[model samples]
Target: MTVGTIRPGGRTARVRAAVLEAAADALVEGGFDRLDLADVARRAGAGKTTVYRRWGTAAGLVADLLADMAEQSSPRTDLGSLLEDLRANARLVQRTLTDPRQGALFRAVIVAAAGDARAAEALHRFYAVRIAEWSSCVDDAVARGELPGGTDGAEVIRAVSAPLYYRLMISKEPIDEAAADRAAEAATAAARAGVFVRSAGAVE
Candidate 1:
């Protein structure tokens, strides 16, 4: 099997779970620069050879961790109204970014992506999965005539979370409920005004 693949209900699966947990702890403590396979093995009570043979490198472990995260992420909420759905989405992002462990883990991964190509790809894939999941909310809105027929669901979803992430990663501002609500409102207004609609001349 490929790296990070888990066998069903077996020692292999247990080992994978343990290793991923240890990896997350390591990231939370020291960021991606200090993620070591042997250390992860020791922390997980698994064999060093197993960890090395399976993950090969820190980036490989990060990639696998992101895959697991994508698999385990929550499904989007549908609240009938577009604004309400987007507010829910933004609030979820706010909660995750404000959580002690999840926030630190995300910071480590974001920092890792800054200089590591493999980590960058993994990060991109993770967000892509999340965005697609929430994009359905926008799709439902368009169908209900709450948004323009050609509104880009994915972009609207991105807009809703963009400010929240900026606060988490750039401005060092608080990711409070008010901030989340503002993000959702701005994105909703823009989307309703047809800002997110794809035009024939728009660049893909």
Candidate 2:
């Protein structure tokens, strides 16, 4: 398989993964302001038109890059218990952020997102995909009566990483096992306390 060929998704998804990986290299090597479409294309070994056609501007490219990230990442499958599932999610997030290459890639996106609408949109999609992946675990919890019927699985999943990201992006602290555990604890406690469940038994 090609460098970007063997990915965890479909054909289009594989191509996107290759592009994202190349874009990541460009971002890390050149920083936020120096990202060039040609460079990305060259790095990805993909045609420049393909890059521009698929993602539009640099911001758009960045956005799609994030979406690709969420896709390549393995979704959280049933792992017996909610807490265990959540722990798995936390660990995944922690590992990805801690990884030098992926971590820098995320930082690049965060910086690009500050002033770019396209990048911002892509970041949103990325989070949405990631959150949805783990939310199923919370849903399973409710179905199993491990959590209440009204529990908000999405919120529970988001909670697992909100603080973790906060520390990584803001305080620039480490996202170690302890931090992941803390995130899981706080979010789990809030989830158990009915923080995410809908009040009227309807989607909000």
Candidate 3:
């Protein structure tokens, strides 16, 4: 079903939900390269034609799945302090990346993004949405005089998750609450020191 054909809480929506869930399961179990439209349709109990008509390719399905994931992601926490808000963001990322199925699914998508241009665009958009969602914490902190003016809210939010992702994707180390706390603390310290402040006359 096309987007124009989809109505709220209708069969199209149900099919989309099922297909996206099945796509996530397939990615978690076998990675993106093994994601087949027919297999996903079978798993979702939808018609193969419907799946193909709605999402033409594996990349298309993955892109739609990423969009859905972004929409379903948790909202930012507001604890009246930059450090506490950052800690909440860090812990959320750490928890997601540490889960067995979710970790594998994210790794699969990251790997796919590395090799496919369309998937890469979708993955970047996913992070952009998430960062924008949490950036308000830094904005709120600045208003409260906790962080300096002109601090890059998006960059500060990214800093909170960067180390956790590094461990999950590169260092292959343990990603625990301690690691999350350390990331949050480091980002908070850096933000307090103006490390993420916007440069003057640099076009941001």
Candidate 4:
């Protein structure tokens, strides 16, 4: 089997896994601007025609890649407390952004989203899926009377991650454990203070 090929017993599945792995490698090595379908196919050891036929365009390939990532991402951690859950989420984000390969891949995808509408939409969807998954922890917190009755779980989750992303993408600061802990702490404090509560007339 080729690098990144999985023995899932299906040729199509193996091909897709290989292609997505190759795409990730290419993105890490050469940002989104240099992502070429033919090169990715070559690296994946898949036929160029097959890649083109399946993905159609670079944007399409990226969209699929994001989908795969969202599918494979870790499930939310339920630690019985909102603070602990937020901390877990923050640490996970920190670890991913601090990893050499994952950090590069995320940076490439983010850059791609800036110039490609499809990529942007895919990126948004990926985060939405993640947020939805983790938002359950916030819901649990509200049920436990740790937060306001109408606290926006998704918004709370986003608040825990936004600072970390800013450090990774904009401020160019270190996304270290300390930063992650601080983010979680701040978000938890805000949520406990009802900052994340939805207004009475707000859309659900």
Clash pairs (backbone) in predicted model 1 = none
- TM-scores of the candidates in the order shown: 0.94, 0.85, 0.95, 0.96
lDDT order, best first, reads 4, 1, 3, 2
lDDT of 2 by residue, 9-119 (tens): 677766777787787788878766888888888887788998888877788777666765665777686788877788888888898888887787778888888878878
Query: Candidate 3's error at 89, in angstroms?
Result: 0.3
Order of models, best TM-score first? 4, 3, 1, 2
Number of backbone collisions per candidate: 0, 0, 0, 0
Off by over 4 Å in 4: 1-9
lDDT of every predicted structure (CA atoms): 0.91, 0.78, 0.90, 0.92
- Candidate 1 residue 185 Cα shift, in angstroms, is 0.6
Model 1 residue runs over 4 Å out of place are 1-8, 201-204
Clashing pairs in 3: none
| True lDDT of residue 30, candidate 1 | 97
- Give the alpha carbon lDDT tens digit for every residue of 108-202 in model 1: 99999999999999999999999999999999999999988889888999999999989989999999999999999999999999999998877
For model 1, what is the alpha-carbon lDDT of residue 53?
96
Cα deviation in Å at residue 187, candidate 1?
0.4
Best candidate, TM-score: 4
RMSD of candidate 1 to the truth, in angstroms, is: 3.3
lDDT of 1 at 90: 93
Quality of model 3 by C-alpha lDDT:
0.90
Could you tell me which residue pairs clash in candidate 4?
A: none
For residues 1-204, write the lDDT of model 4, one tens digit per residue. 012435465889999999999999999998888999999999999999999999999999999999888878889999999999999999999999988888888999999999999999999999999999999999999999899899999999999999999998999998999999999999999999999999889997
Local error of candidate 4 at 30, Å? 1.0
